[model samples]
Target: MSITSANQLELLQTAEAVAREKMIDPSLVIEAMEESLARAAKSRYGAEMDIRVDIDRKTGRATFTRVRTVVEDEELENYQAEFTVEQAKQYMSDPKVGDTFVEEVPPVEMGRIAAQSAKQVILQKVREAERDKQFEEYKDKVGTIINVLVKREEYGNVIVDLNPGEGVLRRNEKIGRESYRNGDRIRCYIKDVRREQRGPQIFLSRTAPEFMAELFKMEVPEIYDGIIEIKAVARDPGSRAKIAVISYDNSIDPVGACVGMRGSRVQAVVNELQGEKIDIIPWNEDQPTFLVNALQPAEVSKVVLDEEAGKIEVVVPEEQLSLAIGRRGQNVRLASQLTNLDIDIMTEEEESARRQAEFEQRTKLFMDTLDLDEFFAQLLVSEGFTNLEEVAYVEVSELLVIDGVDESTATELQMRARDYLEAQAAKALESARALGAEDSLIEFDGLSPQMVEALAKDGVKTLEDFATCADWELAGGWTTVDGERVKDDGVLEPFDLSLQEAQDMIMTARVLLGWVDPADLEPDAEELGDEEAASEEAEA
Candidate 1:
């Protein structure tokens, strides 16, 4: 049985057309058909069957040949299955048992099984070739934008038909508050391309951070040219974003360039982000100034930075607190993220209250423990001895050296100071346990419960324990957590340890041991002194 030349030519044209449509090479189809014929012949005629099929594309002519093995009787099965020595010798003079012989199998019957098998093989090869072509086309396009036709949403996520393939738009990556409908044309940034058993797949996203950056690059010529660098960017997606921009060129203003004339450039980017408000701030080398500017539309009275803690305390006027903090703290929150600092915003009143409370705490500690005579107390007050530790730590000699007190009085005062300090020390140690100072006391050699209890009553349990104790109290025999003798009041006078140091030491001791909460340590008074002073002077 034979097919007409016209039929063969028609099949060849159809194959060529399909190959072109699928972007696959046409010759692969002929090769596929030949391989199919060979496989079918082998299955039908047993292992002895070896055949080759060839088709001429232009002429549509076909030919077939069978391969055999030549061998001896001992290798007869091998020859029957493939080819053996003697049988192989009949085809080739120097052939060996393992040699195969090719013989032209006269154009055989056009059986239904062979034709169907050939068709199946062609279809499979076409599909595989198409998949490979699709993979190659998509693999190079990773991280680029592609237009996709929206298909039905699957499980609340949009599935798009990417011509020749399909892609998924995860719900999270879809633009917030935006909707897509079937047959809608949308553009998405390609995140990834993967080859699966079914076919090639692409993952797309509209909310990726890079999407914003890319949009900026496209919208801002300066950014694209690398003259203006996006130092940092933080986005709240559909609502608002804060971008820190810096110019590499001294002459160019990064913020101005990104904003464009009359805000055209940034507005375009904002529109792309679905009307998201963008704050284009000029980045500064000074953190305080940068943070102040970052919290725009609000005036900052002061910026106190605790670099080691990665924190910044911003003080604004009573009216500007809400503005500085923004709606629901969004402004400061984004500024903190952009600046890599934790921001604490306070109004002038809050800050004043904080400072006043601290001052009162120090004054109470000084007055309660020093027990200074009225005359001396007034003199101490005049000399700025607002805290007991300052008075305790001041040298008796220094006090005598002051204009009013004489040497004999200084000596008596020193002795009285010693007695007062001893009483305070005993009280501090006693109070230590109640103040959560037991573990720190354990570090010292002779810290008794009675001593801790006494100290606790006097509010001398922690490093703050001696905040009111005189130098003589520490010198008499008080020891640090390390068991080292506390420096004498006389020795510590010149050093004048600040209240902050005293508070820090207590916190540190607690941290080292775990007896007290770390939060007990308040912000250092001296830490805020400069800003407070400036604030007061400004008010004056």
Candidate 2:
């Protein structure tokens, strides 16, 4: 193939056709042609010479040129592509070292091998441009639901046509046991879009919880209009799912609206999910109240929530236990996901037994530590005084309210409790000092003697060591590892230290050691206060 004057316009026509077929910019195809021509020119001319090609966008004319750069005699390397500045006087009045000399050169004829090589180069560039265009077209479609035509199946994965590109629905991302044939229309969630060496990969999913939520948004006009909001969703693929919703308008019931008239709306979603049963629950600000609603179709006798641990205990009647837990604990599992809390379900009888065991344990502790008889200890426990600290530090008037307890008896009880606690503290202090604890830590006002002992055992024996500790290290926290929350035990966690309290104590220690400036924290505190005030106002 040669760039003949008669067929020069054919180049522009070919570039336009290729660009239209690939749905890419025509200029990209022309650029690829220019590069291919340049490569052929280099092969025809001396390999060391710098050959270039320019294609006119409108006229389709190809111009070829040979360029030689002027350089110092000592720096010149390629004799064909570079010339000495002194030798460049023939081409220019005053040539600089960086100047280039250009002369018109005839275009090279593409032989059989060269034509094949140029074809590959154009194909490579066109493919790259096509991939880039596909990536840009689909990247913003992530998290959206789209209808696609199923192209074919590779192994267990289904490839779908996105009109301009193809998406793969991985086996794991499909609804349980779902299968499709070629040309089947399927609705899927655009989970991800990535650009790879081969091409742009669009990952589609039918099992995502977001798919369910989006379906409802499409079906329910209130949700689409922001009158009702889906707070959370959890799905078991083709089995069962749960969704929590809230209504901003008081007149609109979120659950009722989602259920639709006579179950039409929810039934549509359920049918799309292959009959996946869905439980629509109302959203609540109170976690325990919300959890009680989440565990539907079962009567809950009580709900005990541990906020710090993100756990809850639900007590139900014995007959309702099976219903609350559902088949293979599915109900409780879905409820846990919906509420974002670990749930422990038990019969009412189990709760009673557990309460009895705790009451007896508290009674025994009072009897052993306070020199009280069994009856007196039980009475104290019944009066809600569980520990020595409560008994020792409680107001005298509170003790006087107890049966058969006057001022004198109250005084005696407090004295005994205080004595025992002081002895325990002194023993802990002695042990901490034995473990190389310093007076600097012992004198820290926020830490208890038992806390000092615990710190000493953990090799944190000085105030400086405590100041260097992270808040989570002293207050404990939950960490997400491999999609599961694991507990990170803290040195001071056993003493009921909260994260905020630990942070404040550590900052105080740092200030005392002159390791931190108080003024540096003032701006942060003010900003936090302002943010909190704004949040409260918005809530109101």
Candidate 3:
């Protein structure tokens, strides 16, 4: 309560100056000053008394008062600040039980120590207000580019002065070989904004892929107009980057629009990036066609897509292999990142030679394993008999339908094939148990003996391992030659439904073990699309 009437206007002016410097409201500073004066008054007067201070905004007047409430004797929490109605009535003409009254108290003179305390209070409040303002300004700005002035450097990270506050560009987020001087202005993406114990912090990035996409949006009008969508971005910072853009209107060419006439639009982005080459790839819904566009300037002769595995095998001309792979495998790697698909580049000659080798290997396997003659083994191989399981598990009726196979012979073949598989299963099960697979897994309900054996062979010996297996690995979907049955094609194999049947078995085990809730990792799209898992649970 040290403020006096003569210089009260000086206090208001000081609060206004601090508020402007801190980018906080002047009312907040005035409130902090009022609280500061009340604390000092409490030290001089009875500490048990409830004291309050109010500062007039325009008049620069201060009021110091002791607050008391009239209440019943038994209702008093602090007797010094509350009294019975009979006691309060002696001071006021009329008083009710709930009435409140204030007694004017003389203001305390602000000593050196009290002035220091008031200064600390005002600074604390202003800093808090500043943090809240900064958080609100930048929280929604993440993933968008902003211009900032380089303020200083600490341990190779640049502290940039944002309009609201300072942001730091961490060392890893800076583009390779990029340097900044104090007072230099540069554009950066707001990667993250976090409220820490000390204050709010904004994280900036120059290497993020979203940065390039934002840059293109500024340079390309179609993208800003919502006619073109930036599908994805992949960058090799300080050197190369690729962006996939799709046009909502078929009439407009997204790539051409981004490239502009005489390459003006894309060139602006390149200059800003300090000569980093950019690839503007037209996005396509057909993945194969998209892959072709991604690997531009290199012709793709053939593309074999493995949808289940999320992989694409591209065959190019022999002379284009080096170009397709790029220098140090950068081209294909960036293309893979852009499409979110694993891409394998091969020459047409290499693909042809590989296919021939696989066919010969499969034919030899059939002959030796089945004890069939080369001609009969070739016939089986051409009929798409890629593995012994296909033969061992085929129906007798299906076997009879194949050429040169009669009933008696079919029965004999079935006996021999079953014997081989049984022996193999026994061997695999023994090896799995020896390796450390739990006995409980082997004895688990609803899991087929064949499936348990398969899992053990794959080294999924623990419940944890079994639960985390990806859907495709369990379902084991495979590709065929252009959706046609490849009788002799050795590159593809049908999924093992026996392994797929294990999906539900593993999920059920997870629930029983309490590793996960049945509600989590629901079987909807993730259960390998198999009926066995659902039916197994139903049967149980």
Candidate 4:
């Protein structure tokens, strides 16, 4: 064989080698070469001209040729149209006016340009095939952990060499506070598998949210078996993490299951995370309850939620404030992210102060005119009824039910209770009016001026009325406009009143005549009892 033929054989062998290395078919390489030659010929000649190339697969020898029609006169010089009828008949017996002929052009020397062009086509085809294969291989592997060998680092990012190709482990994907030496064996999740011009490019992350999820799945059998589910997780990698978990089986405690026996399951995950503290909180449908749980190890007393703003105010006991807020505010910070809430932490003292301020405004309403002392003054001191208005609305029955009162005394207390409440009702109306409450009188459902005068004439003028007034005064001593004795049925029944007949009549009259501010008339008996005791002591 000549030197030229040897070089041709070497070229064929090189193409085959490249195809095998790239996992592409050898025929694809030949196709790529044919395409490259066709393009080169077209660029040199024109699209109107027909071009063809033939290659001996075994010998790696190639020949290029052009085909054209044989015309009577050479209208176009480059036509290669020479052929007598006799000679044309040699190839085709039925030669006619439009007879075509194949003219073999001498093989052009494969110059540097042609060789470069062929190399590019072969490389491009191989890359495309490899990319297609890689995409199919990795697309399904997302959300899974894959072990990749560290190949090199570029621009401060680790490049992982996989079985077939290379992937990227960007700096951000690297776990914070973790150091990686060259050739270090590290496990990471395939965050994403994307295709690029070069080949299949995988994105790996050691700090992804799913990383913890996957770790938990591996460590906790409950998670793997579907008994428990990790709803969401937030982490400050290498430091702390918060994960919300829920159990499908109500019989199983989700948090405890996730925690494993003696925390063995969770401890394994924590070890993998380099001792990162994990708070596995039970997931709750109620936002407030979920948030409170999210701030683990910190006891929460109350949660005020502003769902629209994604904000929550958590009140904790003064001693637990630091614990709830966590060291350097990490507890609340993680809670916020886990529950998707903007959290504000408050101590018990702050909450107390807030309650006090609210009480002051509510009490200022009827403290002056109504002699709240008869019912609430002693009770307030005894039971801590800081707010007077809260006391005015107490139910007489509940007050009578307290430890010290007897049934008979409670009965007497009940009769005068409505009068005491009516006075407070009038005061609340005046307060509402002062505060610019529109149609304040309309707000007071049934109380009228005539009702108030009749109640007063019956010695029911103040909140003290029911507690101080004689039974006859409350029953029938007062008269109606027609001069008929006012029936006991017309008076408001004490909550302790057992007779349904009498209670209904009084309640109906109050509702019809508008004798009380609906707001004030509904007293919290607990508060009223407390205030009443306070009032008695003050008087003593």
RMSD after CA superposition, every candidate: 14.9, 2.5, 8.1, 21.1
Quote model 4's TM-score: 0.56
Residues forming the 10-long window of minimal summed lDDT in candidate 2: 1-10
Model 4 CA deviation exceeding 4 Å by range: 1-17, 25-28, 40-109, 195-201, 250-253, 361-540
Question: Which portions of model 1 show Cα errors greater than 4 Å?
Answer: 1-15, 27-35, 47-110, 285-289, 304-313, 348-540
lDDT string, candidate 2, 2-110, tens digits: 7764488898999999999999999999999999888988989978989999999989999999999999999999999999988899888799989999998987888
Best by lDDT: 2
Question: Model 3, which residues run further than 4 Å from truth?
Answer: 7-13, 46-50, 67-104, 392-419, 422-448, 454-503, 508-540
TM-score of each: 0.57, 0.93, 0.77, 0.56
So what's the TM-score on candidate 1? 0.57
Worst lDDT window (10 residues) for model 4?
492-501
* lDDT against the true structure, each candidate: 0.71, 0.92, 0.82, 0.68
Best prediction by TM-score: 2
Which candidate, 2 or 4, has the higher lDDT?
2
Tens-digit lDDT track for model 3 on 262-290? 99999999988888999889889999999
Model 2 error, position 86 (Å): 4.2
Rank candidates by TM-score, best first: 2, 3, 1, 4
| Candidate 2, backbone clash total | 0
Model 2 alpha-carbon drift over 4 Å, by segment: 68-90, 93-101, 509-519, 524-536
